[model samples]
Target: MRSIPSHHRLILAVLAGACLALASPAIGQEAEDGLEIGDAPAIMPVDPSDAGEIERGARPSSSTGDANRLDRGERDSAPPVTKGDKPMVGGEPDALQGINIYLRMGTPLPDVPPEKPYEGEPDTAYGAFQRGLFLTAVDRALPRAQLGDPAAQTLLAEIMSRGLGVKRDLKGAAFWYGQAAQGGDPAAMFKYALLLMEGKEVPQDREKADDYMRRAADAGNASAQFNWAQILVAGTPGVRGLTAAMPYYEKAAEQGIADAQYALAQVYSALKDVPAEKKARAREWMTRAARAGFDTAQLDMGLWLVNGYNGPRDYEAGYRWLSIAAARGNVVAQNRLAHLYINALGTAPDPIEAAKWYVLSRRAGLKDPGLEDFYLGLTEEQQKQAIDRANRFRRT
Candidate 1:
């Protein structure tokens, strides 16, 4: 048996969370809940050394976490509120309250064995991880798991892998995950493959990893499908690129997988031999992902909207979406918003607004040449003022 490298352990952690930790739009009600993007919760990083802890759901809470992420969907135009054009009312904000965004219809709390009935909501492993409440979720459910409940198996595996209330143990975790995978859980399939590849407390096998990935992708695991497409597109020498990959990507994109939608959009946009109709379809995909709150998609979609690519220009709409994206801590959107604000084109220019957004963009890791120029253009006193403003914003 090959030893799984430490890096592969990290991959396993990512794969495990990838299935359940999809970023969905914040579903919220209309109130003054500050939707400041960077202020949102952080997605836990994949940790190789702490694979056992993370794999079992032992997540340490940061002040910020990506609890309220969004996904792509056919958006009904913002409903007419009596207050007129205001920020988005529902979706992402509601998600913060522990509601699943893009709640797919399914039987809530599937049948667990007699020993495991009524553990809790079966839809998420996050709350346990966040509040350090792993044991409460696990102990209450393990009896049912021992009695052959698939949901219990899945939850137990998550607890084992993430180290929620228990000490981390990869091999034991894989056993539970395997039980869930055998019961036809798509999420388990992806996690199983991650473990196989990592060889973390399990035997390493690339062929097995590929098989699990294929199974997960076939089962409509959007992240798995997108990643499989990436593997195929990259052409791993002996593994020939499969034409079969395209439909998988399309399926995932249709499910509002932002990465796939973005890739599909790019493919169509750059196709020289494609007909106008094909280009139109590509733009549609871009539009789909953009509205889902993926930053790259938002930036690309905003650009297309501004340029009237495959449609008429809608600068106001473009600005609105772009502003939303920038607010979400997307550096690209920040830079674009800054420039748009600076130019005062379409919307009135406010240098202070531009400066505020620019500071946000900087925090998002954008190194805009124009921002440096903007800074230099300001008087020494103004530069000090901007610094103070940025610091104050951070403290808030």
Candidate 2:
């Protein structure tokens, strides 16, 4: 319940969009029209605060007040396309738009309920919470929470921590989270463990935090599984922790956690004790993470594909993935993309494209004398075009 930093909030917003965008890549495949790749719309970053508004499906507030507002997910008017607006060419909306780069580092998004059909009866507290009636949710949940209902306790913790309809109460929130964790709520255990680790309104207790994290992981919390794997891998000596961490990492990875996938890839690649088959598993997991829009994983996967490591060589796939990562601001990917373009490895030779990527990589503080020489050898017109492209990429 510590005051969240602005950067954290921004990261949360990015993850919100990314979760929506990368939930399934197959969904995006259906939306790829015949439009040229250059015509693909750039993913615009959503403001973290505005993500809340989007989640609630609320309309923009107007001076005229509530009368003009629409219901959840209802639009009052269509957005007018401006001169520079990039509209979908001929298919469904691009689902991969707005993928966040933080997924590469394995940060999990905040736990939120996925959309599902309601069964018999809806929990009133949860219903009220969903509608943004925070006070009503608190009123409905307080009694149950007091009565030792673990779910209600967790709900109260979430509400209090966010100051949804009450004053911010870090201590109270932490207390409720701990209570819920003790009652065997996996989400609560994860939350409480984080608070314990951060020492926010609670005493720092790494041992207790580790315990809660393990419990949460055992209970199938994907974030907890990934975090516990990290703890095991980092805390245990030699190969013992790494060996112990593998199952948890696999569990999280199977649940579509990109960080876990990347971690597993690293383990399989680096662990000399791992069997050849397991090393092959590493390549598969790396591909999965890369396809999930993890930039670092994308870079590694691109290189792997190019080199045919543990698989058939696929230069085209490598080039495509590298270009995607480079466009998302990965310096390594940018440099690699330049190299690929210059050498015509996976793509048709395009010195201008290579020079443009080289310029972009150089601007990011990556020094490469070979790239510099190649870029300098370009014709003046080609150099101008590359410069223009580089500038355009930055502006977008």
Question: Which one wins on lDDT?
Answer: 2
| Count of clashes, each model | 36, 0
Q: 1-396 in candidate 2: lDDT tens per residue? A: 113232111122222222224222211111111111111111111122221111112333532334322233434345644322244535544333444555545675555678887687668898888877676677788888878989988998898878775666666777788788889999998888777766646767777777888899999998888877766655653466677888988898999988788777866765668889887797889889888777767877888788876578899999988888888787778889999998899999999989999999899777889999998888999999999999889521
TM-score of each: 0.56, 0.67
What C-alpha lDDT do the candidate models reach, one value each?
A: 0.58, 0.69
> What does the lDDT come to for candidate 1?
0.58
Which stretches of model 2 miss by more than 4 angstroms?
1-122, 131-133, 165-169, 272-278
Q: For residue 261, what is the lDDT in candidate 2?
A: 84
Among all candidates shown, the one with the greatest TM-score: 2
Regions more than 4 Å wrong, model 1? 1-156, 162-169, 179-185, 236-244, 272-278, 359-371, 394-396
Residue-wise C-alpha lDDT for candidate 1, range 1-396, written one tens digit per residue: 113233111222222122123322121111111111111111112233432233233334542343222211234234533221123445433223333333344334445467746876654434454444465566555666667766667777877776655677666677777767667678877777666655545566666566667778899888778766654544321112323345666777888776677666765554355467766797789778777655656766776676676567877777877776766655666677777778865578877667777876677566778787896787777667666766665311
Sliding window of 10 residues with minimal summed lDDT for model 2: 31-40
